[model samples]
Structure formats: structure tokens, C-alpha cells
Target: MDEAIIVDAEFVAPVGTTAGEFVPIDRAPAAGLLLLVAFVVLYAKVISKLGKPAIQEFLWEIITRIVPSKQLRRRKEAQLRAIEVHTQRSNTSSQDQFAKWAKLDREYGKLKVEIEDINNSLTASKARFFTIISSAIFLSTTGMKMFLRIKHRKAAIFWLPKNAFPYPIEYILSFSSAPLGSVSVSAWLMICDAAMDLIVTIFVALVVGVIGMLRSNKVKPKTA
Candidate 1:
């Protein structure tokens, strides 16, 4: 019987490994991780404002406290009746069901306003919640780029937060310098990587984009 020879060679897997593994942490990686932790803490704070689960829980807490069970039951029954009627009547024109739609839209609006009020209260308790968060996330993203671009130096100009720009701006800087730095096969390779990234990002963004736009309507006043 012929036995296959086992070869020891490093190869990038065609399909990447998805598993738990340890990479030795150095100062730079550790510092980057620490910064990531800080950003995440702040990001959670921001999402607490934007996130629906938090808001739903918040509303439910307040709702259970104030609204009587009888009232909540009646409201639920009413909503169910409207839904059942619409379901049973297959021939009902969607436009002709303006009243039902109006009711739904109104109820949805009330839910939205309640969520907004909680968010507003949260915003007030923590003023500049969105601005500060957006700024921090954007700055951290840009700072990562600047750290890569500017040589490791102790100079304040390089180290200062003032040097950081908006998130999109960093891409512009990196993209522009690309022409100057990418003069060989290396540049071409980088472009391929960038194109792959852009394609994935755009695809993801399109999915998010639809949801994001719907949120405006979801969060807005009910107008049939």
C-alpha cells in the first residue's frame, strides 16, 4: 500500500477558518484593543439611545407601571379585530381600507412617539448623546488611519485628537495617496483588496440603507 506523504507548508486557506484562536498580543495590538474596548463602551451608550430593544424594554417598563391591564387588554383586542377583518376580507382594496390603515398608522405613530419620548428623555439626561457618540466613533475610525499613515512619533501634531478628521475623510486621504504609493504590483494587489471591500460594504450598506430609510417613516408621524 502506498501512503500519501504529509507536507508541512503554510498556505492561506481558500475558505477562511472560523474558530477561536490566539494571536500573541504586542503593545500596538494591545493598545488598539484597549481603544476598541473604549469605543465599544461608548458605542453601546450610543446604541442604547438608537437600539429598539432598549427602547422597547424602556417603554414596557413604563407601560406596565401606568397602563391598567384592562386598558391594555382592550387595546390589544381592538388591534386584533382590525387585523382579523382585514385578513378575512380578501377583496377589500388596500386604498379603501384607509380607515384601518389610518388607525394602524396612528397606533404605530403613538408607539413611535413613546419611543421618541424615552429617547428624548435619555438624550436630555445625557445631553449631546448622538453628537458625542458620532464624533467619538468617527474620530476613533479616523485616528486608526492617521496612526497608520503618520510614522510612529511622539509629536503632539501626530498624537493630538485635533488632527483627526471625519470618518469619510480618512478614506479620501488613503485613497488619494494610493496613486502615489501604489506604483507596482503591490498597488494593483491593494486595489483588488479595496475593490473586494467596497463591494462587500456596498452590498451590506444597501441592505442597511433600505432599513434605514424605512426607519424615518417608522419613526415619523402617522400620515395615511
Candidate 2:
């Protein structure tokens, strides 16, 4: 009988992989999702900080530049200039020139009404434009997020150790048919968004605190 040789070999997990679990070879999708969630969270924070009116005004300016209604704007400007000229003429004319002054005042009134109409038209157009753009943006972002979640519904970002948490907590992490003890796409997205929001809040608080301290120091009186 031939003697069998047994060699003891220690098992080593691949670098960047857990000891017992096999990690996905391509982590791009998970990583990209994380980055996307973080960016969205950060952008929301920035928009809140800037204030909605400020952002709306900024967007409106951009829209005006891109979709210029030069003719309407020019007409409004000319009407305003004519109104100014009529006021100057009326002011200089004496009671002896009552007819001329009255004619100028009537022209001014017509110009005012025309300008008001132009303003209303412009406001209505802006409202419609903003509505369309906002709807498109909301739909695109929501659709993309839904697609990603559905595509990666069963995929685990990473696995937790068995019994890492209580049953309820584990179930929550493995939500929507994901395997137990693993974080699903939806869970990971929520985690990333929460983490990013926390980080941004902390950073803003730190910056504000530093600025306050510097301002206080600048105004403080030095004791001899």
C-alpha cells in the first residue's frame, strides 16, 4: 500500500475580502450608488442653506440668459424711457402749455398700462418654464433611483456576521427579500444618505463655530 501524504495549508482570504464570505468582484455598482446618495444628500443640504428663493432666482437668471425674449424686453425698456421723457416734458411745461402737458400725461398713462401687461406676460411665462423644468428633474431623478433599487434589490452591499444583530434589526437590514445578515440596496442607500447628512451638518456647525469665535476675539477688549 502507498503511504498518503497530508500537508497542512492555512487558508487565507483574498485581500479586501472577509475571511469566510466571498465579496463581489465588481463593487462599482455599490460604490457608485453610495456616491450618488451622498451627492444627493449634500446637494439637498446646500440648497437648503442657500434658501429656495435664492436658488430660484439663480435658475431664473440662467433661464433668462438661455431663452432670451429680447424683443419683449426691449419694448418694455423703450416704453419706460418714453414714460420718463413724458414726465420731464410735463414738469417743464407751464399752465400756458396745459394742452401739451395733458397730452404727455395721457401718453404716460398708456405706456404704464402697456408695461404692466408686459410684466404679467413675463411672469406667467417664467412660472410655466419653472414648472416644466422642475417636473422633468423630479421625474428623472426618481425614475433613476427606482430603477437602480429594483436592479440591485437582491444584491448585498456587504454581509454582516451571522446574528450580528437582533432578529428585527437584521430583518430590517435585509429588507425586501434580501438574504439575512446582509445589507440590501435600499438599506445601503438610506445609510449612505444619513451618513452624508450627518457629516455635512457637523462640518457646517464647526465652520460656524469657528467664525463666531474669530469674530468674538476680534471685538474683545484686551486687559493690560
Candidate whose TM-score is highest: 2
Off by over 4 Å in 2: 1-29, 48-52, 92-94, 140-144, 202-224
lDDT of each: 0.44, 0.68
Lowest summed lDDT over 10 consecutive residues: which window, candidate 2?
1-10
Which segments of model 1 are wrong by more than 4 Å?
1-121, 152-197, 205-224
Query: Which lDDT tens digits does candidate 1 get at residues 51-111?
Result: 5454445555575568665444555565565456445444445598867666666665565
Clash number for model 1?
Answer: 0
Q: Across residues 41-99, which tens digit of lDDT does each residue of candidate 2 receive?
A: 56656554545566567788887778868747866686877778676775766587877
Candidate 2, position 26, lDDT: 32
Provide the TM-score for each candidate, comma-separated.
0.24, 0.66
Q: Name the candidate that leads on lDDT.
A: 2
The 10-residue segment of model 1 with minimum total lDDT is 152-161
What lDDT score is found at residue 94 in candidate 1? 50
